[model samples]
Target: MGRAIVATAALSALLAVCGCTVQGTDADGKHHLPVRIELPGAKASPSATASTPGTPSAAPAANVLWSRGDSGSGVRELQARLRQADWLFDGPTGTYDDLTEQAVAGFQGKRGLPKTGETDKVTWQRLVKMTHEPGKWDLYLMGGQPAGAPDPRCLTGRVLCIDKTTRTLRWMIDGRTVSTMSVRFGAQYTPTRDGVFHVYWKARNWVSTLYNSPMPYAMFFSGGQAVHYSYDFSARGYAGGSHGCVNVRDEAAIASLFAQVRTGDKVVVHR
Candidate 1:
């Protein structure tokens, strides 16, 4: 009995090393083991027939819709919806870059989905249910928006009618909108004052004495506040802000406005 036990122990160890499983008892009460002989250069099955103890289960295959490195109107709308849910900021840049990936992961994690950073069908459905359809302006928040109806104050005169809500500036000549362009404003702390003001001064090529920044085609309305061309705004889009100045990104538009707008032109900044 002792010898048989020792032989079974040794056989079990050998089979384990050779990648075989030992099991069952013979009719004579001896151990029976099955050994699999792997032929040289033979192709074995890729997956195991049965799972081992303590082994991790395989992750489910993702049903991907949109993922990183993707770009288009779809990604733009995704970003816009993410913004609506307050999960993203800085863009509807239309490219699923690092920020968009992180935002998607965060959203997935919050909703108890796998945090894979991919916009899978399940994730997309969940997000769609939570967010409303993004409008044209929402998708083009950083860029220009189609001009809404002119504000009551913007009507009737030569006016640089600035609407804070639309983030647009309309150059109106005798109540007719001659030109319109996208605009940006200051930060929350140093906000662009919302009231009726005027172009008290016009500087074609001026520099800020306080901040020492160039202010081209500057039309100063209130104290230190002007409607001017902003290189930063043009470069960074809506990601940056001005120092209490209304920033115009389009250089040619502002240059044209500078030519048309005389000193003491009406500048109405309203929400």
Candidate 2:
């Protein structure tokens, strides 16, 4: 009996080492040992599937209405309108490039539309109307001049109206308005004030000392108001909308305006 008990104890110890435990006996009076199976270095399944490194997860493709460079009258017309509206550059040369894509995205973002960078019917319609009639002002109100006002000079060679309402800067040569282009402005909290001012100074690729904003063509007009290029051209003029600075849309427009306007150019702002 003592030898039998020792043998049973030894068997139980061996089973424990092997991760096996004695369970309740079956109806046939046979002892059952349950095995605790384990896989070496096994990892549990993740709650979510791991995404591919550096690759964004699959997202539903945006509904594209217009193809890039679809040779058609409609496409050409849309491209032309976009160019005129300053939503695109170099007027629809029948070639779609990075500039065109960017302009489309900008237009879509401005109108509170989908930013698919595709010229759809809706986008086309908006561009056409906007380009045709850039400004919709019944009255152009000039702000009151402060005490000891200096003599206002008329630098009328090429006058550019940085419209606060349409978020566009229009160029007028010899009192004849030539072209207008869209522009971004300051935040809703801090906007470009309305008043008659002049281009006091010029700075190429000027960065703001107050904010993280980059002004490519800095044409200083008022105390802080200037005509400059901004990344946020999504807000095309609706209100007194700039950080006391008139913001233009693209680099091309900025360059053009800067080249035309010199130091002490007349910058008239009105309602």
Candidate 3:
């Protein structure tokens, strides 16, 4: 009995030196020691799973962000956040229109996020960290204008550098944009021709021979391609396009451009 006790004590001491817990004896009186073997410099396993199926993750943080065709105060707030980052121009229109999508895309691209125009919770969280809270006017943007950087070619002398990507017409003289106007282009089926050309002719109060619509302050560049004020565009915003022309929405700005531009000035319609 003494020897048996010594043996059991020795076994218990050995188990203790092995860094095992004293789970006490089992039903049979056999030691039920549970050992958690760890390497010399290993981190401990978590007591429980950090995330479960329905549990929110650190990544994406939030769900149900914003996307196109979603119009509401939430979208306005999203736009306000983007505007604070300078990725969005103009005030909030309370609508997730093309402009807002483009701004979202720009912001995502800058931040190395997926360049989807939609605002997921991850996108929103990143933006929130970068920008401050929005004010009433910043969220609404009662009145503002959207503009873009001129094409590099527009920085040269006497170039009407029109960028289809930005939908902007820059009146560049001596490598400077003296005037800039928001413009739209033909639809997908009638994409404006991208090339360098000269304004071969000008016709004030010109009527479109093909469509029979009035084209005020028309400056013809390519074959039947003109830069002119579009009444339909003015009434419809970007909802309409010309047959194959650059449609300027601001009539007053185009009329002034018509006077300043010479018949033979350069017209660079680029992507």
Candidate 4:
């Protein structure tokens, strides 16, 4: 009996190493014990609900979407569309990085879709219709330049000259453009107001009283609208919106702008 017990334990250890399971040893009698084993490279029998012979088992992706970290032409196309909308600052790099995600989320918000920085079927379709199919140069940004012609109003004194057509914000000092950056506007409903305005307020770390969202480095120009840093803009890129305020994605740029801009600097938001 002692020999048998030692043999059983040793066999069990051996079976474990061999990837085999011992069964029906409830009574500890080796005579009635059963073992089930599967050899390497052997496959289990399919169930009745399995696919028919000669048919492909994997389903084609129907809801295929692109988000951050993915790479390919899809991401390139997404970047092009966003550039057309002035949401994507850089040219397409063929990889869906954080900037791509930001652009997608901003676009989604403008269209009143869920602010999930992903390129779903619906988002793709809408973007395709709205933006021109990008040429090779457009995607790669071989020669893309910011709008140079500032409005006459922006030529004198200190001014934040923003142009929707150019998709640029030119920081002007004494009739000369000092700085420029890619910018985006609000949705059709909550459009960033156009025309000349003045900075009425400045909040270094402002939270929206209405939207309950952060508006850091805010320089208020029109009513509740302000020029501020948006992490949504920074993280998601052009894929988000402000509540009628100018959304600057670059945190460092906005921080500098917030500091330099006075309480009544000229803000010209124009076409």
Model 3 score (lDDT): 0.79
Leading candidate by lDDT: 1
Predicted candidate 3 versus true structure: per-residue lDDT over 13-87, tens digit per residue:
776566454567688888775445444465545532235578764443345577889988889889888877888
Residues 1-271, candidate 1, lDDT per residue (tens digit)? 9999999889866765666544577899887765354434555443433345787545434478789999989999999999888899767878899999999999999999999999988999899999999887678767756667787887877899998888999999878999999999989888999999889998899999989999999999999999999998887677678899999989999999999998878889988
Clash counts per candidate, in order, are 0, 5, 2, 7
Q: How much lDDT does each candidate structure score?
A: 0.86, 0.60, 0.79, 0.78
Minimal lDDT window, size 10, model 2: 138-147
Sorted on lDDT, best first, the list reads 1, 3, 4, 2
269: Cα error in model 4, Å: 0.5
Q: Give candidate 1's error at residue 224 in angstroms.
A: 0.8
What RMSD does each model have against the real structure?
Answer: 14.8, 20.7, 15.3, 15.3
Q: Estimate each model's TM-score.
A: 0.55, 0.42, 0.49, 0.52
**Steric clash pairs (candidate 1):** none
In terms of TM-score, the best-performing candidate is 1
Q: Considering TM-score, which of the candidate structures 1 and 3 is the better prediction for this target?
A: 1
Local accuracy of candidate 2 as per-residue lDDT tens digits, 176-195 = 56656655456778777666
Q: List where candidate 4 sits over 4 angstroms from the true fold.
A: 1-132, 135-145
